[model samples]
Target: MSKKHRREEDDEHPDESWLLPYSDLMTLLLALFIVLYAASSVNISKLEELSHAFDNAFSSGINILDKNALIKATDEQNKHQQQRHEDVGARPNKEQLKQEEQENLENLKKKLDSYIKQNGLSTQLQTQLNQSQLLITIRDNALFPSGSADVKPDAQKLAVAIGQMLQSYPDYEVIVSGHTDNEPINTQEFASNWELSSKRAINFMKILLQNPAFDPKKFSAIGYGEYRPVDTNNTAEGRAKNRRVEVSILRKYTDTATDDTVLDAIAAQDQKDASTASP
Candidate 1:
């Protein structure tokens, strides 16, 4: 009776071994579903947190989850890189800037020439464009009286017109330079040609600055006096040519070289003056 009862118990149990694998399969399926759900959101931070948790829980780190997170991060980085490239492509390059600036200066020169010709003031005013700058030269008699540093009332119109024209190029550096003949001057107002020339340059520059369109920081005034002469002061015609004012619109590309040349000329003149005075 005992033996028969034991056999019945064994038959009733009927190999509970299958339950172990079925439970394991259910657990694996649950984990896989959780991983798939996390991946669908594409939140790298959350994925990284989950990966770290899995790494702590298991001896071997969560290699599969880490790989998915890396892929997501790479995709995002690539998207940002592509956007940056497009943005850079939309902006003007250095060569384009140079070309545009050159065009602007050329157009400005043409307008000035047209105005000078139309007003029949070509004899008094002249414009020349070179590699380093666009120079506008005005005879001293056109803007001032004999031995006077003040600008004539009629010349104010010319100054105003020039100031208006310069409004288009606010970025350019403007230099107003005053020059004089080698004739010695000793007046009550001006002690010498140096003071006369300097005052003239400052006064003219102030007139241009009155337009409010010009940047004060970009504008400067200097006096060369009898030095840096374009013509010899031996003849009446040469002296007339030497006594003038120059408005220079310096080029951005050659500004450094232009400045160096001016400095060198001034130094050389100073040395010559010192040598002449020593004797």
Candidate 2:
């Protein structure tokens, strides 16, 4: 009975197991896993590159990049901008300076013209007006005796008059220049025209300095013997013209208009005074 029971139990357990569904399920799962793996692995490196590119594009302009290309480009742009700023900063305004210069020159011109006309020195002295400055020309004969560097007594009066006029505007500078003809001088006092001319300029300068209104710091003497002649040296008339002294009033940059408006105003006032006194 025990053997029979054991046989029956074994026979019952041995009932053919239905393993097809289980096997099929396991195979199908393996196939699905394989398909998933293949799809995921396809172009894995390319996908990673694209992701990094997208991140970079979105991150742009937030901060400066340390990459070689970005750094080089940024440096170039900065250099260009810096250069532009320097160019603009270096240029001074032009119109303002010109206007100031004109104004100052006009004032000097009016005063000089009036002096020449009033003293009946028009024949021996003249004033030239130009864009840059005013020049007062004095004939050599009127300033010194023949072959002498000393300023004549009459010349001293003229110098005093000029000094007084200059005192009214102490800000301007006075340039006394001496000019001579081609005639050579051989004397104990002056070996050549150069010496004579320079001495004459110095003498005139001294006379100007004697005046209380004259400032020595504002005066300078220059000698241009036989050079810078306004006329030809070959003729007597030209030589006479060439042998002269010129007192130039330099135009200040600030007095022209915007820069030199002060000078211009002075000049305009001098002109007005002359017109009022004219016959």
Candidate 3:
């Protein structure tokens, strides 16, 4: 009877049921710790390689990563790479624009020189290149009478030829500058060289604008009037050299930052001088 009772009690009690899930949870926790340790202690080069491989696997349009976390990392890396590529491509366009502008200016200078040689006007007109722009110089003796601002009838022919050649180019800002030797002027029409230089510049500009092809907005007349001399005024030949007009064509879009800064400073100083001028 006792043995029968013990058998019944054994049937009622079975093996523990919770052990399977508990052991599985322990195993998963152990695996997570191992992965974390491997990530923290791996060699840097190896880590980079792993990261790259992971990126390729996930974002290569072939999602190989079984876990979702690695795919997000790959997306971030892809976005970063795309941004870098875009940033790198941005500068070449600016460089190309600068190159095009430089080539265009050089061509303009060449044309000016060719025209000067062909016309046999080398005695009165000359072309040159400097850091700033292409300069086509016209001697005062060729363009105007002594102490007079009027451009001679003969000089108008020369201006027409220049205007025709310059019409081919419409990009540049043209500055027409009139300069005179350091000499005092006493005349019925004008008491100062400044007035004479300014009037001469205006008349020359008018001649140039007569062509109708050269834009008036692109042109400006400035009188240096014995200032900014290219040669010494001590000798008659040097003074003659200094008494001249220059047509300067600017050759840059955004490349003339330094030149523009210098010009701004000069303009400001000129304004100050005019304000302080005595009557």
Best by lDDT: 1
In TM-score terms, which candidate is top?
A: 1
Specify the poorest-scoring 10-residue window by lDDT in model 3.
270-279
lDDT of 3 by residue, 1-279 (tens): 999999999899976778999996786577557655766965465467556655675567444334675666557667866887899887578768867877777887788788778878788888876556778999999988888888888888888878887887776789998988878897988778888788788889888888767778988999879876666677788789879998898766554676788688778866654443322
User: lDDT, candidate 2, residue 190?
Assistant: 90
TM of each candidate vs. truth: 0.69, 0.55, 0.60
> Model 3 clash pairs?
none
Model 1 RMSD in Å is 9.9
Candidate 2 segments exceeding 4 Å error: 1-101, 254-279
Predicted candidate 1 versus true structure: per-residue lDDT over 77-114, tens digit per residue: 56866888899999988678767878988999998999
**Under the 3 Å rule for N, CA and C atoms, how many clashes does model 1 have?**
0
Ranking by TM-score: 1, 3, 2
lDDT of 2 by residue, 1-279 (tens): 999999999988885566888896686577547545644754554344434543664577322223664465446656866887899888766667666667656776788789888889998998886544578899999999988988898999998887777666677778999988878889999988888889989999888788776678989999877656666666789789989998887766532344466567667765764443233
Models ranked on lDDT? 1, 3, 2
